[model samples]
Target: MTVKAEPFDLSGKVAMVTGAAGGLGQCFAKTLSAAGASVVLCSRDRDRPELVRLANDLAGAERLAMDVVSHASVEQAFEVLDEKGIQVDILVNNAGVAISGRAQALSDADWNAVVDTNLRGAWTVSQQLAKRLIEQSRPGSIVNIASILGLQPSKGTAPYAVSKAGLIQMTRALALEWARFNIRVNALSPGYIETDINREFLQSDTAAAHIKRIPTRRVGVAEDLAGPILLLASAAGEHMTGSNLVVDGGHSCASL
Candidate 1:
């Protein structure tokens, strides 16, 4: 009898993580590398030092410049990957932006920026990955990094929330349409993971009061999302397409 490899093991696989220069994207790339997948770190600038350092530190890792908000940039990046003969087996659509503003006060610029980066950008990237996978007749996984605010509305985050909500819906729709091709698409919605961009706010008095609203009584850290990402990226979640894995420390549950 032969022993099967662990379902979570990603040995010999390739994972492309967008927005991988820093924050949660960094953690996701590192985690996938640890699970034995060759990671492709993609960001607005491929030459970013942190991305280069990470690629150097990890085995079988490469860094690429890809701006999710720019279709031409995304296309060019994929063309380069094709030239390099790198077929991504797992795609993490983790590139997103959040602009805080009430619906009434939000400028068109603010709304468009958030919506374009968070929703339209994710769709563009996912579509590119899925198209390549289908053309190659390869099965793959796609993990969309979403937010609890997508499920539970919050004040002063209208544009961000709407974008994430659209993202969750996009994940479901893509999963439904691509299941026939054996491609899994899912959303991993985080509650409030602390990242460099939000560090100041997380330490502020306003955040202190807000923390109590969560059942866990604390906002999560970037490391908190490692498990959910792995589950979705590997064979462990092969049967979980179209599902939304909430990693919000029960925050979304309270609203439900």
Candidate 2:
């Protein structure tokens, strides 16, 4: 007897991705759209022509203005979606910032900015989505974008590391709590991926030295994360929750 494999189809599902203007968020938006999900690409400023162009290129794509750092902005975005009857079945909490400073020199504002956007903003979005899903009696999936630094800290990234660590814990807590509702929450932790934002840094001597230590001996690209993101966002991972999938090119293992 032969058995058929489960389909990873996300057809007819609606996906909302925060920070979809560029970088990993852009890659994520494209990936989700290619998988047949109606994607809502969100950014702080939706007026950017590039965003509009990207949205036009993807099937069932729409752009929206959303600032995860502000509660009002989050609520407004959701309201717009509600008005349009766009129910979000999958959420990619990919909006985050990194502030580089020595631990002792890190200002309160810098710390708060990173924490508020990465940790607090994620919570705000997740809470809102959870409420809506529960009210509608629907099962949903949430994939939090975390970092390898969250598991193993490095120098000059105190604020970023702390925020991502908190996010990892948040993923587990929400996953455990929301499982009762058939809602799945998981974290996707990526290592140093070469994106437009970090390309210059990755070319520097400091980054080169770091790359040599990795078992893969190469840096990752934005597209490298696409498949993993799709897996967690689609039915392929229905039985998975409270799990942290680390795609770090074995960098974390090098320490051992």
Candidate 3:
């Protein structure tokens, strides 16, 4: 007998994941697809081989070339979706960059790149989606991929941590303002997840010492955040908004 996925099922929903070419972004796209949502894998380059391959592996998936930092690019991406008659109800703002450096040493361009992509970019995407949802009187969910560093301090991650902190606050502020429209906004902050973005750092001596501060005594894998991602994306978390779900293996609570 065919069984229904009662709790985390996302059938009949459409999820768009940004930065789908990256490690955690890829994981989010795959996870949403596995839960029955028709996924749209987005990257700066739609024709990227990795993104194209990912789209081919999923059912009813589409590829979008979107640079979240550019308002024109974001607007164009949505326009393309509208042309295709695809209405996305689930959005994963997972496009982010980390430039490792101290605050004093980082260049203005580097700082702007990180902040523009992580904070302003997220705002643009959320606002775009919320406007359409409100127009159609439809409900939707937005999941922002944040980090433990947003809640605390991390060396050599000044820009990334600050950007994530802004995103977390943005999640709450948007949730409060958009709840009346039935739009739920939340953040998922992961701790030291092993991905291409930070695999080398997580495996390095500095990270090794830092890992001991986590109660779990180990770094997390992308799979570790799947449940939290689904909870914020699906009906299972209908009543949840303005919430930041930190999936950091107790790293946030740990003391030096």
Q: Rate residue 50 of model 1 by lDDT.
A: 85
- Model 2 stretches astray by more than 4 angstroms: 1-6
By lDDT, the candidates rank as: 2, 3, 1
Q: Model 3, 1-256: lDDT tens per residue?
A: 7544586899999999999988888889889999999998999999999899899989999999999999999999999999999999999999998889878999999999999999999999988899999999999999998888888867788989999999999999999999999999999999888877887787788888889999999888888888889999998898899999999889889842
RMSD of 1: 1.7
What lDDT does the true structure give each of the candidates?
0.90, 0.91, 0.91
lDDT of 3 at 214: 91
Q: Model 1 misses residue 50 by how many Å?
A: 1.6
lDDT tens per residue, model 2, 1-256: 6433645778899999998877899899989888889999998999877689889989879899999999999999999999999999999999998888689998999999999999999999999999999999999999999999889888888899899999999999999999999899999999999876577778888888899998999888889899899989988887899999999899989861
Stretches off by above 4 angstroms in model 1 are 1-4
Which model, 1 or 2, shows the larger lDDT?
Answer: 2
TM-score of 1: 0.96
Model 2 error, position 109 (Å): 0.8
Q: Residues 17-84, candidate 1, lDDT per residue (tens digit)?
A: 99898799999999999999999999898899989988998998989999888999999999999999
